[model samples]
Target: METQIAFAFDSAQVANRFLNALKSSGIDNLKAKLFRGSEKVIVSYCYEDKGFDQTAATLDDLASRYDGCEISIR
Candidate 1:
């Protein structure tokens, strides 16, 4: 099964940094994309169920570092 997480960050710059940090962690079978809004950037992440916990934790850690970052699982 595949799991998905959607969330928002303060800005596209923050979103980019988040994605870069995520990719740098070297997780496999991961996919992510970002959508820009006037004020906030929305990010959608998808990965295998096997890696869901680790990926979610990584996202939580990364999100904490940025302002107005929050994860909304769907």
Candidate 2:
């Protein structure tokens, strides 16, 4: 299974913070990219046997922790 999460923030600093939080979550199957101009971070994950709900929950938690951050999952 594969999941892609796009995070948009008010500033680059906030976006970097969110990216750090995602990396520290210890999800091994994830990849992240930062788009400075748009102040967004894109995270892509590939899991062998996991459901999307778990990923969504994790992302939701991260968003709650970071102010001015919005997430869209695809």
Candidate 3:
């Protein structure tokens, strides 16, 4: 039951921060594909069952920390 998670950020810096957090969170088999554009950062990951909960929490924290940064979990 792997879930697809995508988080789009407002900037590369925020994206980097989020990537760091994800890495530090100990989620195995994670990947940060393309960090394109100065205003958009897209990160995608495959999780083994109900991992969206963790991703959502982290995204919420990121949103709170960085103002104007949009985090989309889908």
Candidate 4:
């Protein structure tokens, strides 16, 4: 399965930090990209069912850490 996440930030630095954090969270098969024009970061992951709950928990931690940014999942 695939999960996609997108969030916008007011500054590029913050966006980059968020992207890095996701990468370091130990979530498997994750990929991330940033769109400069929109100051948005998009992340996607494809993996088996085992890591889904952990991924969601990691995301929740990130949401708290980057409280100033806007995040959405699809």
TM-score of each: 0.63, 0.73, 0.48, 0.68
Q: Supply candidate 2's per-residue lDDT for 52.
A: 42
The true-versus-predicted C-alpha distance at residue 21 of model 3, in Å, is 1.6
Poorest 10 consecutive residues by lDDT, candidate 4: 65-74
Q: How close is candidate 2 to the true structure, as a TM-score?
A: 0.73
Candidate 4 lDDT tens digits, 1-74: 88776777767787778888887887778788885444677767764576445665566568458753446543
**Backbone clashes in model 3, listed as residue pairs:** none
> What is the Cα-based lDDT of residue 30 in candidate 4?
78
The lDDT, on a scale of 0 to 1, for candidate 3 is 0.55
lDDT of 3 by residue, 1-74 (tens): 44444555667786667667766766566665434444444545554463335764565565457543444543
Model 1 lDDT, full chain set: 0.61
Candidate 1, 1-74: lDDT as tens digits: 56666657777787777777767767666676674453343444455556436666776676677654554543
Off by over 4 Å in 4: 36-38, 50-52, 68-74
Give the per-residue lDDT digits (tens) of candidate 2, residues 1-74.
67777778778888888888888897777888785455788878775573444775677678667764545543
* Cα lDDT, model 4, residue 61: 67
Q: What is the number of backbone collisions in each predicted candidate, taken in the order shown?
A: 0, 0, 0, 0
Please give the ranking of all candidate structures by lDDT, highest first, separated by commas: 2, 4, 1, 3
Give the candidate order by descending TM-score.
2, 4, 1, 3
The Cα local distance difference test for each model comes to 0.61, 0.72, 0.55, 0.70
